[model samples]
Target: MTPTPKRTIVALAIAATLALAGCAPAAGGNAGNDSGGGETPTAGGTLTYGRLASASDLDLHTQITANNAFAIDKIFETLVSFDEHGKIIDWLADSHEISADGLTYTFTLRDGLKYSDGSDVKAADVKFSLERNLAKAGPLTLTAPIANIATDDAARTVVITLDEPYTPFLSELTSFASGVMPTDFGGKTEEDYLKAPIGTGPFAVSAWDPAGDLNYVKNEHYWQDGKPLLDGLDYVFVADDNQLLQRLNAGQIDAIEQVPAANAESVDGGSATTLLNSDSWAIEQIFFNTQKPEFADKNVRRAIAQTLDLPGIAKATTFGTARAASALIPPAIEYSAADAHDEKPVLAHDVAAAKQELAKSGYPDGFTATMLIPSGNSARAQIAQIVQESLAEIGITVEIESIDLASFRERFKAFDYDFMINSGQSDAPDPNGLVTFQADPEGFSNSYWTHYTNPEVTKLMHEGRTTPDGPEREKIYLEIQQILAGDVPYIPVYYSPNLHGTTAKVHGLESLPNGSVRFQDAWLDAK
Candidate 1:
């Protein structure tokens, strides 16, 4: 089902700016209550948050989902973090210096640092955490250019030497994937640590159930004094958006993420709740499994791309909470081709052109296919329906299949679908964060599951990573986008804004540009 036409148009108009600015503040209502403005924060309540999905795992080094990152951000501390303005700032490290040649980095740890278990945090922990991530070759492997790590316990310093000058290295350090852990996981088994992980962040996990609620308690040893003003945090998993909103309206939960655009008005109008919307570097797209025989031909893929109207689909699904995406990189990130479509419209919708392209393929009369979408995501469900209708006009029969999140993820990772609607958000401010994950063939296991590769694109990705941030770097990414546009491995749909809902009593909750909600300083006013 689609949102009302009026709501969809209005949302589309407002979201156009979000597509350009990428990190604008909350547009429609109260941005969020901050600790400043002469209003002293009153702490002590345990804020209950309604999450749309359960975290697959809490292992910061291995897990790569946003659900896991949200929980891990609360339990772990990164060497650096992004401030309100999206600038990288020191967190665990008090100061850092980069060599003039850009191959070496030295960081000084904050003095008297202690973990949630009250163990002293040393440079060895940082070295161990990074080395572990490197060995595992997880998300950090693609962006981190580390060659060696040297730590000095006496000086409280860690020095890293890179094989090459990597521009996004510092920004990558801000990701939760780089979050620090004990040298030997606090002397607990991997199984034991996953149950209740300890970190130097604002909170520590007290209990976690894969199918139910996960609970946390304030970290007394957290270095940031008088921060994380809540007594604790309680995350309740609610799979459905409607149910999540109902819990928020019924005062059963304090806040929720991924609020549906159709329900944004209700939340904003309700006296008991508020809607928070902000620009995000998130993109929703339809990925074609090129391994499938039906989609093996580029002409067939481009035919499918031309058959659907991205703007209409985006409007119907997001209800103006997103802008129709023209490029893989959202406009907010550096080196994004914000005007690529204007220069050359590769994926523009044209049913006649689609028919012509199909006529040139093996299946001139079109073919039957199945589209996969994760259940409980209202927007994705709507997108599937819209795509089903659009494809029918060209003699293509599409059967929509909805599966649970876990099953959907497993299928996605296994390349087990003909095509699927999925979304991804940037982990850091640099364009390299999501671009490398989505486009680099060898970097992230065939572009994080698309399995589409181009020799030129691969070379450009490598050049883009080592090249300094300047006109030269921008040219490399622009060329990559142009190439991907013609290859049609994935069809860009829309750039989404981060939408969240909160009870009026909840304050100090802010949405980051990378689509994360900051609950570190959130609190509850007495209801």
Candidate 2:
């Protein structure tokens, strides 16, 4: 589960599906359409994936990291699946319905689904998997909404109750954390089950070497008809991004994600391999520790937010792939009715306005503080330098400090900092998770860093979560965005672009809005 924050805790790492102005595709852009007629499907080839980190285990309910999710997603079946745009749809389940009151959900399973071990899946297993997920360390914004779960084996039905109405509740089921396992295999702690996990998925865990390699073979009885074009998958763990890129270039691995921003330019322009680079559903931010006396007043935060040139930073940071992100809920998420998100500038660049606010903040002469960034991310380091210079223009001297990813996370969780250049991926595919998490005093959400206790933010987040109607939910979220634009808790810098490298011979590998790869209908062809 812990693969060193593959959650794309990017300096600007992310993937998502909101239609923003000038937004790139999650798959970068469609390449190899020369075969407009399409090519014949070929099976029996093995796809070796060069992963960003090693998987701790394949147990979904216990650990769901970005690294393992790529593995477990194929090995375990989720109740729902997300589309190219990150909207939730039925997968293992034939259909689902939420109550009008927005507190209960009913799902009917697809007929004849079976575990990789050939065991028939029952509704009881659905109840167990979800309840187990709720019992785990998965994000509370996604889990806390669920109050109860019940099963009816005969009807092949699963019923779920929520403590409150949550708009993204349905989408949350797409996670492998909600992956179903055989009821007979239920007794093992997620640790023991890692030894042998049985699920209704396209692939089965054939071998696991934790630090070396993890292999997955096609489930002979895979429910989908003629699906999973590849015979097997090999996830070779290569923690170093440079090595991963080199391996892909050398044809050592069939594909790789998280291509280093430094190497993206040459790779994207070269003919050696296919480059899929697109906008991701993540936002990198420079957060102000609101509790600190220097930033206790919101005006200082606003001053700093407006001083930075966000567009320039994004272009310079992610090799011109990631764009300037202006909102907490990035432009790639579904914030507008037009399949786009409005990144209303809460504090767009205006040095005069910034100086005015700084003066009002009782820091007209400016102040000195420290900005923490996780070591080893070039994107973050570059952006930090830019921010330091921007703040200096407004009279704030930010001493940039670099710490390891683990310690950075530790310090961030403790809310011990003056400011930080940090990022997070959306666990729940909807905006509710990040919007509310950032405002709510939940330490896990890192909202505590802002020390923001706005009742309006909390109320709108609740309304946006619970409201069942789309139009109504839209109004609530827009107001919430409007408020956040003015509040200046954190200044979003950019939306991390999803950059992927694969052999030009490979086709149909979907770059899901979450920046995940799915090779279900993929095929290999002659070079």
Candidate 3:
């Protein structure tokens, strides 16, 4: 088993995706001609969603993927939440304050809050949840900067003490992993709790079909004044986008997640459908297992990074909307320095340099390596093909090994591949969120592959995490980005936008930058 600290680091590294809160559409009744043809519409309707893969687990802690996160976000409540505009606002907690040093955080609980089980939500539950994460409760455990947790029942307040000042701590608290679970429930294992999850969100699981769909109903007794506009939610596993589009056109489902870029325009062009565009907190990149023999050579890594055409890949994969990225940290973060940012350099078709680097690295003859990719993701497949063709020019052969979501995750976790196209959604708006991969030996869940252990980089990251924000902190962060750029542990790729397609009948769905959705203010208008 990985050490507790390393596991926590891995947990943080798995997702850097931001949330999109309260994202709204451009017009109303966008779903094909909203004609009230003498039919009375029901007040409550089921919102069916399409997902390529079924969730591995129902527990919010293990719900790391976008689809699972979307489903879990509806059922679980975070202490703090980002509004549609990406502003931090209270949700479970009425208010919160950070100490001057930024190591201590205090939160005041909201009154009348109760778990789905009808138990009062207290400060002790908050303390228990944070401690559970630090205790390595599951894959979502992220104890970065968190040293200890304490609560004062009499004062109705909770206090969190960190080992050091971390700027992104507050943002991270709003993550799905840190979502508080009920205290009274005792379970023997993770499997027991996941089968039937319970939380304080505005929705609760009414029924489930493990192989197909899960149903959730509104929490009428919710603490918030008004909530869960719809009567119930039905999550169906529709693997095909066309089928999803057809269903939505037929008024079967309210909204759908992950409308493929290939069909974004078509969906928008539909009379009743609208394409809702928002910034995805996710960043797509090609990661190399630095521990592997084929990737140990920095020359090889740099050569590959210098030869591929990122713009071409973005164009081919994301329908020309994505910007080719050069930096590891996405542009959303505040601490990222402009000079250190990767400028999406044009390697063009540099066969000569690629060959030369291969020669220098003692690989005079071509070598073969396996590339892992997610099954059914057309964009990943296209990029993999482009990379394969580009590498072939330099006497390198890549055998593509594509697998379903389950196999893909297990294989990647086992470090069984040489190269892979890994997507990241950063939780915090800092470069340190990226460092969790390199924090410890196999730092985060995603770090098992990077086996690139460097005392200097580690020391610098440690310093950057605790150091005060100033010229010194900026200089350290910029230096780290520069070093990682040159080292090429992962080849930075294009930043893709989060695209969604929904029926225009739905109103008040604000698109958030963090790529998270909220149904709080959503309402349907009968035409």
Candidate 4:
């Protein structure tokens, strides 16, 4: 949840599907040749996964959680993909060219591609997949500037016309929104499709256990040969991360994501498997509700921000893979300037200063604030407890409230708490998402919590959206970061590490931004 001035909040009413277009996958060109051309006995086995929670929907357009993304990445290939080093690489589309003006991008579709339903997937399908989100006008939309999309009648090429220059366009396209889906193939309604979606990737959803499990089977006619090596895939929603770890150690599941940092050492010490770590494209921050008296004052917020031990939190909550963050954009973003001060957050332990600020405010006697957190998120709960103790030292009382994951998210959306811990993931480093916190209706509706507003900040946010690349735009974003730091509307926590644990027998698991997992090339070795 983020804080914003409620009065100035404007909602951009674009289609929900359109919001995900910025992160669509690169077009997967033709890959029709059968692998090894032989009557190989069907390879099938059940691979179980530990999902953090049950997803609200499975429709590619509506699902963005780590568990759903893991399944989707296997079923749908994007036009572009990120390498292990976070660099862009080709995936579905053969090659792409952007006009010198950066407003027009043309994609050459791959030939011989067919949907699981046996319909030819042409450039038009790609265009539809890219634009459908905008047509749906739902909650899952991307916050970039796109003018229009058109595909040639031959269905072999797609062209995108942007309202303005967008340098990070491809990066945003790597999301599920841009994934091509067959039109009205089954009797499934749009809502049903989202909850139990279909796709053209290496596997398809075989069975979904609404309360506890999901399963996927290999596509006999998958586009790529020798793909989806596992016989089948399973995702089990385990509310407890500790239980997930225990299951993994007991050989019930092959992998689990985001092991609690506190228990990571234990997992590492056990013979279960190796703990994988990578730089994540997400930031975990403690957001302040500026709309309320509890955190309305910047002085109080800054004192709180300056008081915590970021390094200590990183070690205690996220293990060694996370680092203290000072800016919205993680260091992995290539465009950040070397001299940017906002990017270099203040990391200090000054409890005395914190106390002085508390004294200056009317709360010299210290007041209690409510903390809303997801009930089963072990990592967040641990971090909140740490924060509770830290703030108590400065005469501030934090009342922790843990609720169900679904209810917790809804509350955050509604700005129903004084403070909370959450994460914002970035596909590529850009300030466009800032609109969600600062812009009107389409932005964080919960901005009402902060009661923070600045026409200048709003103007700069629009500028960043409209001007994808330019010296002026870069300067504005840097300034925006600085302003945010000074405002102290959000307390900088640590950027969590994207960690994945895999048994040695499982091969070809790749890490993506947002703590997502991709397994196009994965295969199971016989135990």
Per-prediction backbone clash count: 2, 11, 30, 47
TM-score of every prediction relative to native = 0.91, 0.84, 0.86, 0.85
RMSD of each: 7.5, 6.4, 5.6, 6.2
TM-score, ranked from best to worst:
1, 3, 4, 2
Off by over 4 Å in 1: 1-31, 35-38, 342-344
- Which candidate leads the pack in lDDT? 1
Tens-digit lDDT track for model 2 on 383-498?
Answer: 89998898898899989999866577678768788899877566545776566557766434546356776788777765665555456766877777777768888877877777
| Residue 324 C-alpha lDDT in model 4 | 73
**By lDDT, is 1 or 2 better?**
1
In model 3, which runs have C-alpha deviations exceeding 4 angstroms?
Answer: 1-43, 145-148, 186-193, 240-252, 337-349, 438-442, 446-448, 510-514
Model 1 — which ten-residue stretch has the worst lDDT? 1-10
Q: Which candidate is the best by TM-score?
A: 1
lDDT of 4 by residue, 1-527 (tens): 11122111111112224333333344322111122223242345666767787544565655555555566666666665666555555556666666666667677666677665566776766766666655554334443467778887475777888776544466666556567775563456766765555567777777877666777777666666666566777777888888887888787788776677766667666654656666776778788777778688777887787778877887877767687777665666543432364445542468988788777775678788998888777778988999999998987889999998878877876778898887766543344443344333334343324456666767766655545455666676777666676677776577677766655445556666556665555555555
Q: Which runs of model 2 end up more than 4 angstroms from their true locations?
A: 1-37, 57-59, 62-65, 98-104, 140-148, 161-166, 184-189, 209-213, 261-265, 336-344, 362-364, 448-450
Question: Candidates 3 and 4: which is better by lDDT?
Answer: 3
